[model samples]
Target chain A: MISPDHFQALFDPRGIVVAGASTHPGKFGFVALHNILSCGYRGEVFATNRERAEVLGRPTVADLTEIPHGKADLVFVCTPATSNPEVLRQAASVGIKAAFIASAGYGESGEAGLELQLQLVEIANELNMVIVGPNGQGLVSTPSSLCAQIVAPYPPAGSIGIASQSGNFVSSFMNLSRQSGVGISRAISVGNAAQVGILDMLEYFADDPKTSVGLVYAEGISDGREFANRLEKVCQRMPVVILKGGASGLGARAAASHTGSLATDDRVFEGLCRQVGATRASSVAEAFDIAAAFSTLPAPRGPRLAVVTTVGGWGVLAADAISSTSLELVHLPADLRDTLDGLLPPRWSRNNPIDLAGGETKDTVPAVLDAVVGHEEIDATLVLGMGIQSNQGRLEREGPFYPDHGLERIVAFHDRQDSRYADVALAASIAADKPVLIASELAIGDPNNAAVAAVRATGHYCFASAERAVIAMHRLYERTVWLESFGEPNNERH
Target chain B: MSRTLSESDSKDLLAKYGIPFLPEVLISQADHVEDALVGMTGPYAVKLCGPNISHKSERGLVRLDINGVDAVRQACHELFDEARPEDGATGVLVAPMATGLREFIAGVSVDPVFGPTIVFGVGGVLAEAIADVTVRLAPLRRYDAMDMLGSLRSRSLLETFRGEPAVDLEALADLLCSLSDAAVGIDGLESIDVNPVMIVNGLPVALDALVEFSDVEVEP
Candidate 1:
């Protein structure tokens, strides 16, 4: 596990040096350097390439001796496994407290590689240096604008801390989040997990002030009891979402090959996931959505929920989603029904979905929201097909308008309507201590629409699909239910 | 690679920790059959006891539903005749033929990574096919046992289905916890399979059980 002091040095480094930064873009060192410089990191970064005088625009030093070594906090070892021990020795001499090793050919390559991995860990331990990965992609800390990873461009910066085992999955999750406008706080790919595992990352995330959520994509865990104990502790402070791969015999073998991780029966893992309070997401996208909901929205007090939708079909679809999750589309109380009777059109479906059935206009969204979230019986609300059509319709209409006329007027009008509806929905959700998930037909289609982006900027997720929104709400409820089942004590975390 | 303990011995082992097995007696000779059946009810099940015979009924070493002393003696003779050199039968044993509205399998197996784990599910002939089972790490708390029971896909079997009364889940949980305690506590114990535990009037009664000890040499 990365210690508290080391987390600060590794994630929020004031000064960083890339040990093998390359002049060539094709090399891993160059990719690592370019990501940090392009992400607008406020901290100073030095490139150490013996073959080159400079990397990108930054001046290159032959070694740590060229710079004030004691001041550099983190060193990215963009070198081979064979040279990592010497780099560790050099880094330890410089007083570097932490490092992210992007080199593979560690334990994943077999017996010999496992020996090398042990050597690397031994060196780091002796030097008191926190090592993130032996065979990892890289690490990214959004709060510090530190994109030290060698993958896709940095994801939109926010507060969801992600720790994934597969580097490819981390990049894919970031790309998906980028498209969905889901912001990330910190993400690390714990390759081989020779030193840091899911539990260690989760513990660090717990102490992270900027991180209120921990998301992990793990293939396997080394110790079941230790993992469970740490997970239960971390969950008390911040909601943790885990998406495990390798559920099958063949898949487990694959996972073992990829990360040198021992595979437990998936069923046992499920039992442990329930025994602890972490919500298990079945897919990468679901993990992102659930983490976003748990981090942004207040957990639902109960499983009872209400769906308010402009499109009746979407409400029905959301109802199906609610059924699949541990949520109920319960009947509204008489008092809430009376309020809705006064607000919604007479033709609106007098059911739990509260379908507008084509009777709603953009102006009526506020009152419709007031009645839906206003119910004491409802624990959470899913507002589907709300004012999403405006973004897509406006974009298409103004696509070739006035042969290059100013499009700000149409965009502003759309933002005004979307923001107005969003405010009403969020205010009620906040006041009632319940979450309001918004999904629209067209705007939700983009998922990262300007309106959705504006709403997500507030930290809450507004999904394009009503089903995902409902599923996220259900996951939040499940997390609360699991915690409640444990009767979490005040001092649950150590 | 482990040896199976005899039925009576296995029952004794489980009874030490509060697993309720049916009343039975081990008789090395047919003359002791009538005496052994003294406390048992009218219907009885006679089986050939062995150190290595794991499946008595499948090996034709078992005779069930014997009502009279003559029938009991005939069953004893038949079981002895059926026993082969490999059957490993050393004596005849008689147990009360337990009847119940439901059957369940409660046992423990050693998982290579997690160590001992408790298994609970529907039992009898359909156990393998129904395969509606749930597992929890052994040395389970009462709460863990209850959760395991509730998590079974065939959980409805424990409820009052049709006109049959619901199986006493609290009692089942106790049985599971006891087995888990043994699975975790005993160093020599490798696995225990108590199949078709008869649920007589909602109370679980072990009708048949097999306890296997680890064959691996323990480090001195």
Candidate 2:
């Protein structure tokens, strides 16, 4: 296992030196160097190579021996595997605690390469240093002035922390996080995991005050016992979302040869995850998606959910998803049903779905939202809006509800009159503090794009299709219910 | 990691788990092989039982069908000569000869995926050559073992094949269930193989058995 300090150094470097940094677009070193500078990192940056007198017009050294020792905190060994061991040795000799070998070669090749990779491990152990990878793109730190040569740049620093085995997947996740308005505290691509393992990163983030959620992308783990034990401890502190590959046989074999991971007898690992509070994701997308949701949404009060929608079709779809999952739709009492029946016209469906019909304005939508959320049994609310289709529709329909069409205007009016009604629906949810996901049936405007843009802009929970919203709601409900039964108090990191 | 259990050890282990084993005994010397044979009925069998001798038939360490003393004596000498001290063979097992119209093999092995698993197959070298076996998680129920037995391609042998009475499947299931239970109960145990268990007149009998365990854990 890697110490918390070592793992933190990779993501929170006080000073950085890219050994092979350059400004040339074609060279990997140059691309990495330019990305770090462009991300606006305020730290000492140095690029070195034997051939170049300077890199990206910054002072470059021929080698580590040329640079004044002890000044560089973390060294990015942006060279081939054959050249990395020597760099690690030189860095270690000069008291550099961490090195990110952003080069490719060794173990990932074949037997001969594996043998060479083992030698690198021996040198790292002897030096008491941690090596990220001989085949990694590198790592990123959102809270610090650090860019350890990770392939992609992410959003401004926030709480979610991600550690992954595939650099490409990490880069893709960063792209998604950026587009969705989700922020990340740090992300590390532990390629091949030849030196540092998953538990190392888990431990680091478990104690990290900035990180509220942790996501791990792994093909398989090396030490099952160690992995389970450490994760059990860490999960008690914060949520650790795991996205495991090798769910199939051929993929399992590939994972083993790729990273020397044990891929058999998955039940032991499964049992461990169930015993601990950690959540398991079926794919890479769910890992980050759920992490982002958990980061923004408050914990749900109960699995009981109510869907308030202007579109009857989407309301039915959301109800179906909610039912299929752990959350149950609370049956309205006779008096509450009578209350809802009097508010909407006879054409409206008066079930738990609470549809407000097509001609209803945004004011009428929130009125129905109040009745549904007001149900004492309701734990969370899924308010469905179709104005997602037209920007003009949002102005024309909801604009009347707001005096000046300002966010504060909407918030203030919501607090004064509609807030009371909406609160009755959201009371138990607010008191229990469950998240309400407000979404659109389908965009009426540019149907294809704005619907997606609307949900992404809110930075709240949204599924691509209405059916997915149900599944997410139900899954979230089931998860929240299970957590209530299993949760221990005062263990949260932030 | 691999060691053969003596007859008493084998039978005791199986019987404790409710698996039936024919009466048998292990003697240290060839002299005792004859005496042990006398206590049994007319039909008897003699085997060279040793810790190191894993493949008994391949090494010609087994001899069957001895009607009297002379045959028992000659079989013992031939078996003992085949398993000389140089072969690192242990002692010989003399027990009541188990003759059957049907034969089958059952085994339990530690699979890396599902842990202890029970495997059943058609008996003899031919079945092993074809690798005609089905495996399931261990500590098996009788129905699970029966299901595994019925799944084999050569399952017809387990029936009343060629007018021979049907092999007692109930007895086979019991044996398999018992073996699976033993495997689950015994940690650090590696493998157990019971091959060519004779089903005489539809009644099964263990002709030979082998058990092995690790002193230290081996990587799965």
- In order, the TM-score of chain B in each prediction is 0.93, 0.85
| TM-score for all models, in order of appearance | 0.88, 0.64
Query: Which lDDT value does model 2 have at A81?
Result: 72
Best by DockQ: 1
**Tens digits of lDDT, candidate 1, B9-104:** 777788888888877888888888877788677688888887677767667777888889899998888877877787565788888788776888
Clashing pairs in 2: A22-A30, A373-A425, A374-A424, A374-A425, A389-A443, A389-A444, A389-A445
Task: Give the range of the ten consecutive residues with the poorest summed lDDT in model 2 chain A.
Answer: A254-263
Please tell me which predicted candidate would have the highest lDDT against the true structure: 1
lDDT of 1: 0.77
Q: What is the per-residue lDDT of model 1 for residues A1-494, given as tens digits with 9 covering 90 to 100?
A: 34687888889988898988988899999999999899989998887888757788778987766768667889998988898898888887877888899988989999999999999888888888899887888888888999998888688887788899899888877886676666788999988888777678888888888787888888866565667777878887778888999853432211101001211376667656666667888998788888777667776778898988776788888888887766989887878777777777899888889877777665777887876786778878888765565565466555767224555566666667777777778888887767888775444465545556557666566775888888788778767666666675222111
- In model 2, the runs with Cα more than 4 Å from the true position are A68-70, A93-95, A247-272, A333-343, A389-432, A440-459, A481-494, B1-185, B189-220
Chain A TM-score of prediction number 1 = 0.90
| Interface RMSD after interface superposition, model 2 | 10.9
lDDT of each: 0.77, 0.64
